[model samples]
Target chain A: MKNKRIYQVAEFMARVLTNGSKNLVTRETGKVMREALEGRIQSEPQGTVVVLDFSNVGIIDFSCAEEVIAKMMARLIQREYGDKYILLTSLTPNQEENIHAALQTKRLLALSLKGAKKPKYLGVLNPYLMDTLQLILERKSITARELADLTQVEINTASTKLLNLHKARLVLRERMSLAEGGGRQYVYKSLLEI
Target chain B: MKAPLSLHEGSFEYLLSQWGQRLSYPSDIVKINLRDTKFIDPFGMVGLIQFGRYLRLNGRNPFLLLPNSLDVLRYLDRMDFFKYVQNLFYLEPQDFTIEEKYLRRHHSDVLLEITSIENTDDVHIIVEKVRERAENILNIHLHYGPMEIDSFVVALSEICQNIPEHSKDMGFVGIQKYFYGKKLKKNVVKIAVMDLGIGIKESLSPKYASYASHWSDLTAIHLALFKGCSRYDDPGRGQGLTNVRKWVQKWNGKMVIRSGTAYTGLIPTWEFAPYKRSSLTFFPGTLVSLILPEKSL
Candidate 1:
């Protein structure tokens, strides 16, 4: 938006794309991204969409991917800006696997930013789903049935995703005693500690 | 048969209390039974190492019977105890027999003797005695590096020091070295230092009980070889036995320790097992043996 060459996007939405980067993703870059997302979200009050463009990036080592992006950037952005995040990359399967494994633990919203077919779905679903998941996480507890009803998805698909989230330890299940029943029912709760 | 080392009832800690005292001489023949004992702990390992060192030093290799515990064998393997004394033998608990000829004919070349604690003050005296006697008897040069010699001296000093500190009995140190004769072509050197006193079990268990299980002799052997692996609280960063084990293993040598009836050996393959009781019973002591190949300089 400002004459910065790093990010360019279409009208009605801001798409930040970084390219041809070689150096390790530093704390400075993470802070800048966080501040930008936070300012945009605060001004719009509808939350901002942030995409990390990694098309020209190579050798995403532990420092860049795991330490910087997954641990610091997503967390700072989510906490300060409530921004929806996506990863735009053509990473190799192994690199994607590593990034996915890292992000799976954080419960960050990540959509691959390649192939025009995905952009439409990304533009619409990314903002909606990120807001929903963020709400569920902040509330600290949500049922699969409740998520299915809200997302308009089938119960089975929502339950499957919730189970995956539980395995990742983003959420925990505890057996709760029901007043009307003799047996206990498992209740899901977020594991964010806060 | 000698009386078993006395300890507070059922406490394995009492077994190690005899680390540095004069043990009674062992008989040429030995017998071991593991049926009555439910478990063997580190103190028990000290007892066995002491006794095995005594018999091997005395020129009589004893036989042993042990429980079928792979965990025990694996534990001993890590310490490298079985690498030292070749004559000390082990069999499954079911295979033990007194009728079979217990002594191997080649074992007569292994000789063991004790030195008065007064002479231990001179490190050169003990080294010279071992080197001279080994060369004169076996005709093999007992050349040792400075680091190796220093480790040996440290181990002897620690054991001797423990004798006066733990065991009330006057500490006597035993020395044994194995030489190759014409019939036994392989050159091997075995040295044992023993004391009649409180063994390792009692001295360590009180302080370092959390790091070790009060159960298998093998665990005691394990604790003996690793750093911070002591049963003594505030154990003075002791590296005596660990250094001994490392030096011996580096040259493909062996070390066996006997505290009471429980014994652990470090050979090419580490084996720790309860050996047969010595024909002559030890009062209570610790025996540390080091064995190296003749080619090992």
Candidate 2:
């Protein structure tokens, strides 16, 4: 049985929280954590705890996590807010590592969503799809169809994934003419130098 | 003018801090007295945005206090801060009108005021002549170091190329280098290049039109200096103005650019600001003035 109380420190803040029925938290729960920190900053004018009940969430996108948490944290710090604590009920080792890496690159001060439970140092892993997409962008102009063909995925799935990458500003899209007819086709290029 | 705000951070951080500090005031306020201000950076713009947002958050009231310069405010506006700070009254400097009139009256001594040059090939002739005149008056090797010469060539080429490429046949290049003798520290070299062609108005309009006015000359010049901005339709390497800005700052130089009625001043040490309008009229072109240090390499 998992202990009800888990306290841990990731980057800067110290997080403490009680486990709930769900194993992972919802997106709304994450937003509430951010709001809770802001409220704490307003009320206590000192340390704040951002609580995340991840008892319900099954998977989380690392980029989405950074956009919601790390970016907001940086903005709060810019406003002169002090250290913040994040408490999560559950986070997979891979998810934790990915979140930590993104936070470090953004130069944000963040604590693990998990509290005191020693986070297992799951071996370092590579996000191969992200890496592959970045590499293809550098050498040649790639389209969603081309990427799908290379990855052996459906065109719609590849297109949707590419759109998500574009939203993160990791790739740029340009309109080009397709051969069959004079219609505009979107070409994707990676912003990263892979 | 208000008391100066201080912060110990890079240009970006300092700007954010100033904005936060400014927002610590009430809304429905028209004028802010920035009296004791000393330093400014690209980030200094955040303060202006905060002030604007404060007004909006309160109501539709405008802030009417005069800033140190219209040029500075204009630059901020071009950087997209104007959208945040909707209402700003760029206070004209006290002596602005007088100075403009004075320069206009003495315009005869201003040897070259070529407003619209129709040819790109002629740019080389104009550059050589101006170089000769500056060297003759200062008695200093105007083209001493390789970097200096290279920068000069690049600056002139960039501006000249814009004439034929963007301005079509409606732009101008003006040159005026004044010498006060070699003995005095105040002896100066001034080169003003003016282009009346399309202006920055037509150039940057395609990208930022939704947020900016087509006639905002200040915004045009600001975008020109912004990193990776180009008026060209293609994804160009847009290094022209960025390089110009870097070179001028490296040498602790001064540059002023005026488009339409809006103008911005760039002093070596301090942040740039807007200057009040003068009666002096040169064709509707961009005017750039560079005052290189006497011993600058």
Best by lDDT: 2
lDDT of 2 by residue, A5-53 (tens): 2222221122311222111122233344455445544554233344444
**Per-residue lDDT over B110-220 for candidate 1, one digit per residue giving the tens place of the 0 to 100 score:** 232334443213332443344334444344344544334433443444444444445444434444343446523456554545565556655566655566545434445
- Each model's lDDT comes to 0.43, 0.45
Over A23-77, each residue of candidate 1 has an lDDT whose tens digit, in order, gives 2222233334445544553453222234444543432322124444465335544
TM-score against truth, every candidate: 0.33, 0.34
Chain B alone, candidate 2, TM-score of: 0.50
Off by over 4 Å in 1: A1-194, B1-113, B118-140, B143-155, B165-168, B181-184, B210-218, B231-236, B269-283
Q: After superposition, how far is residue B31 of candidate 2 from its true place, in Å?
A: 38
